[model samples]
Target chain A: MSKKVLVLGETREGALRNVSFEAIAAAKKISGGGEVVAVLLGESVSDFGNELVAYGADRVITVEHPHLKSYTSDGYGQAFMAVVDQEQPEAIVFGHTAVGKDLSPKIASKLQTGLISDVTDIEGEGDDAVFIRPIYSGKAFEKVKLKEDGVVFVTVRPNNIAPLEREERSGDVSSLSVDITNLRTIIKNVVRKSAEGVDLSEAKVIIAGGRGVKSKEGFEPLQELADLLGGAVGASRGACDADYCDYSLQIGQTGKVVTPDLYIAAGISGAIQHMAGMSNSKVIVAINKDPEANIFKVADYGIVGDLFDVIPLLTEEFKKVM
Target chain B: MNIYVLVKRTFDTEEKLVVSGGQIQEDGAEFIINPYDEYAIEEAITVRDAHGGEVTVVTIGDEEAEKQLRTALAMGADKAVLINTEDDVEEMDQFTAAYILAEYLKDKEADLILAGNVAIDGGSGQVGPRVADLLDINYVTTITSLEIEGETVKIVRDIEGDAEELETSLPLLVTAQQGLNEPRYPSLPGIMKAKKKPLEELELDDLDIDEEDVEAKTETIEVYLPPKKEAGRILEGEIPSQVSELVSLLRSEAKVI
Candidate 1:
């Protein structure tokens, strides 16, 4: 059977999330010369039909309803379930965002199939898809194979894969509707925080800190450096526990997993938890006073000094170039 | 209102894990309730204390899981439920576990469901959200802070680099992360009282879920030690020569420059 890859696109406040396009680009690679279907469920599909094709989706399977405007588990799941049942795609891919995180497992359960969630890598392997997931709080890597015969599910972590653009290519756009009267949960409203710049998960450059950052005042330098490079800031679990920063900024086993192009660790001792989150970055740079710190193990570049000094210099140099 | 806090007995993360024959060796290691889940239990118990609700601690594991269950009860949960699943649970994927738990909560009067954002063991982080999906309940994850204000739940989750706050009604599902609340230790009296509290044990059928419903999409193919690290060479010299040597290493050998 020819491969048909289905991507579960995500939306934020009634618009397609960037990760949705990134997922479609990834699914197209796994298509192996088969069709690419982007499954979209929301209140309105009229506005997103054209953008879906620009991101390499051969076909757009849109499921729209008034109740589906906000994110309700039942409404969205039912819509995707109907689409999957109607068209038995070989594999389904999703970007592991909040909506995708909530929707993928339910779809897997309804289908009585298996899913590889939060996958960072995927490759086609002889009639089956091989998925790479972090196990043991990112201490280990597990390569999983979806054993089911048809319609396997895999949710890749956002920003891990680069998005691609395609021109002069398009496919069918179909609509789907399902009964959601029995849904148990409802999203009454979706409130968003108006923040500028890329999400940490999507940033190509990252500047992270740890407990060694002394005090809350120490974070300003890192922020200054991040701003200079148009990057995001991350924290270690210890720093979060110390209240030097919010837990949301913490990057560790219990926190967000990010894979950026350039990752700079400042003052972090590189605990296993912290490593689990950002170890997958393309290039790693560590700045710490402790020469014996474990962060140097995986760091492509290491500076055995104070971040307060090194960061300002680096930021200034980068500013001069940009 | 009844609150359910899910707990899992896992290997102590502080200890170095040894994988023998593709299974985690826990013969000599200590076990405890997942650290993150401790926050969930603490938050649930706090909610119960303030609102006059019953807090039920639930787990799906072997009889050994009872120790953690007892610990939670000792910490002041009103009751405990153990789905004795060790024999049949080779590796119950998140989907199967969520389906089973959702069915178990079907007729129960639960106003809130609390789970750790992710178990350190499986590290899938999909269970809580999947359970909310199966139950069709509003789900919020990575909640760093939570406040209950008379039938409403306000949550603060970390998004990108900022804190994103959400407001939802009762009878919802939430996954707790660190900083949500500090888990409390069991008082001497509370520990003693836990022995008298009821710990209900149920079979798989009690959850109204079949064993075959959940299929494992991913399995541990193998577990082996990571690659060895190269010893660092001590560069002892004047600053200029050391910098020159480092530059040489980067340019010629490492080629990372």
Candidate 2:
């Protein structure tokens, strides 16, 4: 008998995020003998439901409603509750992206279960399920034995698991209805960045700035360079706090984590707090006036210079080539 | 509105965490109330003070968490409940913790329960809503500001890019964000008074919590230091020369260009 695993396949702008596929891969690893079913909830999801099979879902449970055309916490949770009540799988997994972050807890609560959230590692083979989550903000990890239940809930951290290959298989897509009348909260609007480039979390190359960038105007050239290279712009806590950039751009212990192929630091002093976040990146480049800046400790290449002058030159050169 | 603030004690931020043998070495670590929980406690007290209702600080941890509970009591919470779990229990992993807490709150007659959106430690941000779910009440996380009118609770959450306003009924759960309020420091007088404040301690058995069902879903295979980053070679020469060399390196060697 196969263990039954349920996955909440998350999406944005009608397309499934890579993290959803990654979640499916993780579900495949831990499901044991269970069949993996992907739950895709949205408005008009018929066209998108077919993609789940290739991504390793043995079954696709799709909940389509006009209110769920876009992502809302209430719609997703109710749909999930309905699905869980119907399937009663051995394990339910979600991608710990923004959508899952909001949706998982609600569903878990409704089920009167514990949600192992933001787990970097998960393994369930024995009668008990085991999870590993960073404690004290990545300072430590706690190996947790989940509460005994017929079904377990987990939210996997994004980008931690690589997506498995697409097999030549298609699953059954079943439509389900959810009663969302009790949901009072509504999404008035969703604002997206107008910039056309790789997402910060998914970027292969990341050029970051910090307080050393000096001013907001200094970021224009860095943005230009990032745009030229189809990369993303990131910032250290100092830069976000200094008002040189927005908090959304912050990449550090208290901010976003970037593990791109190339991480270029412009004027970042590399505080330990900041390093805790992005130190996992494959390669690092540090450009700063103070040669002893801690960023060089992590950098694969160091260029001691002023960002104001260097960024413009670099941007122009990259632009000419592109 | 009558509010309940959930506080947690965590390893102080200053402590150098050394991961050894798949565990955190706490030989010289100091503990403090989680910074975010402070914000939650302070915000709850402020709301209670303004709205003319009681504020209670609740924690699900060992005796060490009582320090934070006492601190919350001194900061103006009317009462404190320390739900002491086993010493080895990991934070937020025990569904029994949330379940026991919800059961305790069920009798408190609270109009709202306030907690830090997420503990800085595990950063799971799930317990409050899970408790709310167990309690079968409405829930909202990441609330930056909370307003109560009549029987409705209005909350503003810092969502992606902007603040979103959510309205729930009384007896709702709210998880507060950092910007919610500035937590007050325990002054000399407050600290002195804190020692006199009543702290009720309840064991898991006292709360009638049966932990036979839930278990940890995942386990840590290993805990190791992140790979050490090798220092970079300092590029020599003038601004234009350095730029050219940087470009050359990025193109030929790093290949990120």
Candidate 3:
């Protein structure tokens, strides 16, 4: 049952994202006493190799090339394939992030293999493992497995897997020089809009708004409460469409799916589409004056009062308690 | 420019899913064009309009998928093709789907291809890049903005919540994420024109693809609904007291805080 699982350690701003380590954790679960070889590709990424090692990787392969500076499917795919050819891993794991979502499929196609994307949980072990992923957004769940075992490609959803605590161990780091070719897409530049803090997908708590939040300025209070609780601000599609917030903060069937520990839906009416994103939150608190709102139906705690009133009070009360 | 947009018919996200007999029951389900693909169809139409070319909408599904294809045509796609795999193949997954679609598109000489970032139903998001890979072309997924100047193209793709602005060329495939564009609803005249837009129906054999060549790589071990959550507890009385109790409960019962 021993299997060699290769994990792609994804990076952002010269550091390994938490999901990369989480993928290593997943690889450990499915590794079944086998080796976990982690690959990091970039123009410069020796730290990524050591970081993956600090978390959990039997060996590290740092695929470095100038074209790997930016994440183009062609560049990353070419570099990873070179590593794949050399290592001959039986399985591959990715974080299911923006880059992972875009790159994994192309790599799978090159390998002429099957890929299970956005897996939330892994059950069983090794070859017989089953992957659980959300279908219809988060409204339903399905268990899938590779039909015929060739090379198992999996992309694990962010925050769904447990991230390893950095143990800071020195692992075997081998630098790989790869030739990245087939130049197609060139990075012009990147625009950074995400607020620096708890990543929305991985946040422990979320304070979400809806169209009921009204103007763009109406999000100020929600942001305040989110900041107070060290959570992240989220928005329903209605809020995003109404120009109250950005689409990146939107959560629905068409947007990001999150499973936060505490979900505070302020003005959201809990549309089926929006519910598809957060119905799985561990504790949902609905603060709306309408007692019959659909959000209350799915909420674990409901306050039949305006969010503007309830949020500030809750923030103040938590301030005292904490 | 010659363009193709890949579309899928999926369960309407608004409707409640009914899973009976260990499979999702489709008898009473309401199906529509996948929402993300609406962005794809809309973007394809926009690209064709700006660049002066024809847009073809393609799908791989049963005869029931024809309705969704027509919907795309009504939205301004010039032609539609339904690759009916119902009689030819079974248990289609992302791999099989990309294979079938890539085969259908291999000879089309498409200058540009567009599809949804992910389907609302399966949510695999592998088909666009997979098809592009099979066609040996460049691809970008979850794209928010696109611009074309002759053979040169500029794209702004969503990377997490951030954006990566890139430059690529024609003969490129890009998946349409939400915020790419507001998809147009089929106008009355557009719908009328769509009825006569030469909807071609082809089987898998028409693409010269054997069933074994497009076999699905993954299998559904099980399908089930999410576990039901307990009913919510409504807090009444004064807002201040309610908030205090909520805080106390979080610390005592929920323990999340």
What lDDT would each prediction earn against the true structure?
Answer: 0.75, 0.74, 0.89
Q: Model 2, A99-122: lDDT tens per residue?
A: 777778777766666677876666
Q: Estimate each model's TM-score.
A: 0.86, 0.88, 0.98
Assess the local accuracy of residue A78 in candidate 3 as a C-alpha lDDT between 0 and 100: 85
lDDT tens digits, residues A127-216, model 1? 545677767765666777765564667788877667885576666788876665654444433334322555677777788999889888
Scoring the B chain of model 2 against the true B chain gives a TM-score of: 0.89
Best by DockQ: 3
lDDT of 1: 0.75
Chain B TM-score of candidate number 1: 0.90
| DockQ-based class of model 3 | high
Worst 10 residues of 3 chain A by lDDT: A190-199
Cα DockQ of the candidate 3 complex: 0.84
| TM-score of chain B taken alone, every candidate | 0.90, 0.89, 0.98
Clashing residue pairs in candidate 1, if any?
A184-B136, A185-B136
For each candidate, what's the DockQ? Answer: 0.32, 0.43, 0.84
lDDT of 1 at B242: 44
Show the lowest summed lDDT stretch of 10 residues, model 1 chain B: B234-243
> Model 2, range B143-255, lDDT digits (tens) per residue?
66787788766777755324566566787777776457667877888878878888898876776665543334434446655445456778888877777787778788977
